[model samples]
Target: MTGLSGSGKSTAGRLLAQRLGRPLFDIDVLIEQHYGERIPTIFAHHGEEYFRDLESRILERTIQQTDSAIIVTGGGIVIRSENRQLMATHGVRIYMQVDPQISLERLRAQIASEEQQGKRPELRPMLAGPDPLANLLTMQATRESWYQEAEYLCVTNGRPVEHVVQEIIDMIEPTRNENEHAASLIGTPELSEPSTSDPVIPPIIRHVHIGDGYDTIVEWGGLSHIAEHLQRLSLPPRVFLITDSNIHDFYAPMLVARLRAAQFEPHVYTIPAGEASKSQRQLNAIYDWLVDQHAERREALIALGGGVVGDLVGFAAATYLRGVPLIQIPTSLLAQVDSAIGGKTGINHAKGKNLIGAFYHPRLVLADPLVLLSLQTRSRTEGWAEIVKYGIILDAELFALLEAHAEALREFSPASKALFCQIIARCIDLKVTIIEEDEREQGRRAILNYGHTAGHALENASGYGEWLHGEAVSLGMVVAARLAQKAGLYASEDVERQNNLLTALGLPTTYHGTVSAQDILSRMQLDKKVVGKRVHWIMPERIGQVRSMTLPDELVTQVVTEFFGAEEDHSHA
Candidate 1:
């Protein structure tokens, strides 16, 4: 099913999926679940390049893997040549048509209804501004020919969803020849049976979407089968695998060997590991390496490390000689759960972390939890800060789940794959929700920085190497909860619950670094989230809720001072 927004694709598709008793793979929902964000958020954060890339990837995967299912796609899915081709070759295609004006009206009604229910509905960014009807018409003009290419077209304006769905059902099963129709519905060509002499071919991949699209791919041994996956993608044969030294020793050689076995030209480059590697110097080195290898726009750069490598290589992919395709293979817990998804790429400055960057998303992200086994306890434990942030600011259930599994998770137990995967997927989902709301950190996205306002400052003041980003955030969340309490916005008991979770997760709940409150304050003023010379503080009203506001600098200082531990010698740090 395909159509402009408000054309009732979702409405009709739901009925069709039920009638057929098949799963519904609504592209919009799949994109949201896979990317862990919404269409508008993807647009606001990653831009058209990133969104289209994901859209195409998801469309292809949906078509390739499905035997029989209702696959509803966004109208703009036709914008790309690959998408048009993928749909053309597969499915009993149906285009749901509606008047642009009607579409616009339905959208407004949806927005109004969603708001009334306190739901965060997604809008097609292309057709969401003033003169939306004009935008819709313009989009229709661009996509009309493609929409017309579908095998069947059903007008949806003024018609009931059941009527439209039945009409589609009739088209799908013209003579009531149930067997033949079922065969077509399930995409069985049945042209001819190949003899045993025929060459063996790989079957369609089961692409498991975690968030945006690349979330669950790692659990399926996506790394072990990287070569096979690459063979199926449209990327160039020349691949660049970039990682930090700390990561290179663990997985780079194996990945390189596989790529070579598959006849791909893999150029491996290793940078010094740590946050410091996310710098202009390292970025320049990547550029030089790409040039030395005569990298072209068709070439893909694989970021095979944690957030530092993901951010640095992602930026290089975003701007090196214009742009190149990027594939994120995040090996760290933090990178997999937060950094790798949503395409927030950048480098840090001497003054602050991630002060320079772009919203260039990766073409694909492969997260293998098995790889996290390589992380030390400190590295593994810090990622919980971000995960816990999700529960604290948006999802109370996730927080409770973490509490239930706190001890096991802290131990990184290999026995809890299902639990771990669910936690990871849910965390990515919440992150996407925020990006959909405000990817630029102007409004809803600010909530994502619940602990980051002070966290980033503390990270900088203590020196980047002093504390892991997640540990700093864990402490920041604790302080913010306390701040809310002092400001009469929250109860002290809830603050303790939030704090106790972090402590149980093996995260830091207090600061004892050499950095002073004054130093932290000075750094806070320089945070990217600052608005009109005032830093925005995201304080919790309670678990699963947060509000953005500015607290008095004096009060902020007092809270930090209260939580401060005895000055510890950190020269080693």
Candidate 2:
């Protein structure tokens, strides 16, 4: 078991070992036992590097020697790549996840209780700082990528030790059984049979199973096979279809017919097509429609349109009788790539975009790239902005892919279907990984909003529909790139590459419309990401790398003004 200090790794391991009738081996204890010295004393005399080397050797030796044992390791063990490889290959590695704040409190409580016994304090060399909580958070962020490499991640905060242990066991046992079953079938005739389909072919269906949430399936022709996929899920017979007028006119009949063929009842409700539909008045209308249709908790809500429809319908699902099951059928490229996957659902407030919202994960997300063929050029190109954001933040390989296929993507050509499917799947995977790590916008997830801070401000400053959400974000990303360069946080060439990519995709790189810089800044102040009146600007350090920093108000204003045009008034209105 591995996790942050005071994350109950040792306790859980001991309990799990006892329950399993296995020996419990604590690596730290073994080191101290071997040297006849305390951990802190070892660290103080020999330094961290020496301790780490000794820890690695002992951990490898213990794993090699014991065929079946519960090995509780130090949190820092993951820092070494060799240790991680050994753990991954040799045994099931379980990560005990805990909130940094909770870990800090637990450590403090342990320290205080230990002091009462008149014993020497358990000195955590890493926790030696004026702000231990901050230190813990920093350390957690640094090691999170490595911790996620574990086979299973168990959230241990406020959970009973027995419960956490049981969860770990439950997660591991199924995998062990599956492995055994697969081993038993290895020599079976089924494996030797020649298949009609190509064995080397990549799967068209990209299935992302979010833990206890829902599965997200992205395929090229998924919309037509919606009923087939729905049959596999545990959805109710009745589906409340929430779509926009434009999407209804184009795709609703086929979907309704398919559902009917499957003997599932589908009730359709089409709001006017646009951002204007995602308002309180429209939301009330949806509630009225649901009530009129006698929608029940057991019934499912299907959001079938772009981000606007998905957000509106998702919010309705979340609120109407305290949420019903939601299935996202994202038609537009923007929805398929970004909004439809994450559980962020809400209507725009008069004050700002997504001002009213809820963290409601959907029952399923079905993204069909075939729908993009029907999208107008503007809508399709605008969606590319969000796709680019994913590249800028998390995946350099995706960024390169976009660059390589820039022309084909711009035309939305028939040949690009396979490439687009891969793009959508990659983007969805990146988002799912981040969402799994930080389900709420606690820390790491904020990177997903790389361009939204300025983008949302622009959308609010201008009328909501004046600039499409993706177009605004495209502009926002450019502004962020410029700000990063100005602040010397990002390289000039990287910014240029971003601009070139956006320009090549026919996405807006600058706000051409007339909007006051101060007004935009004022709207940005209302952003949810703002902490203590400071906006957390997500700056691109390089492709696939971004960092969030709270910039001074003046610096933000200057960046906004420079990007929107210097003639715009910066003074408060």
TM-score of each: 0.62, 0.64
Local error of candidate 2 at 313, Å?
0.5
Estimate the Cα RMSD of every predicted model relative to the unseen true structure: 22.6, 27.8
- lDDT: worst 10-residue window of model 1: 189-198
- Per-residue alpha-carbon lDDT of model 1 for 159-261, expressed as tens digits? 5343465567656654235554345463432211222222332222123232344432435234666887677676778999888766653455456656766
lDDT of each: 0.76, 0.80
Least lDDT summed over 10 consecutive residues: which range in candidate 2? 185-194
State which candidate has the highest lDDT: 2
Runs of candidate 2 with Cα error greater than 4 angstroms are: 1-211, 566-573
lDDT of 2 by residue, 1-573 (tens): 899987878767765665465688999999999989989899999999999999999998998787667889998999999999998887777899998876765565456434533457866876677888888888899999999998789998744454466566556554544664222212121111122221232334444555566778876657777888788886788998878766653456556657877888877777778998889989998898899888999799999999999999999999989988899999999999899988999998889889998989888898878677656678888899999999999999999999998987897754456688788888888898898888888989999998999899988877786788989998899889988888888999999889999999999775667687777888988998998888889998889899999876677778888778744434210
Q: How many angstroms is residue 355 displaced in model 2 relative to the true structure, after the best TM-score fit?
A: 0.9
Q: Which sections of candidate 1 miss by over 4 Å?
A: 1-220, 565-573
Q: Which one is best on TM-score?
A: 2
- Candidate 1 global CA lDDT score: 0.76
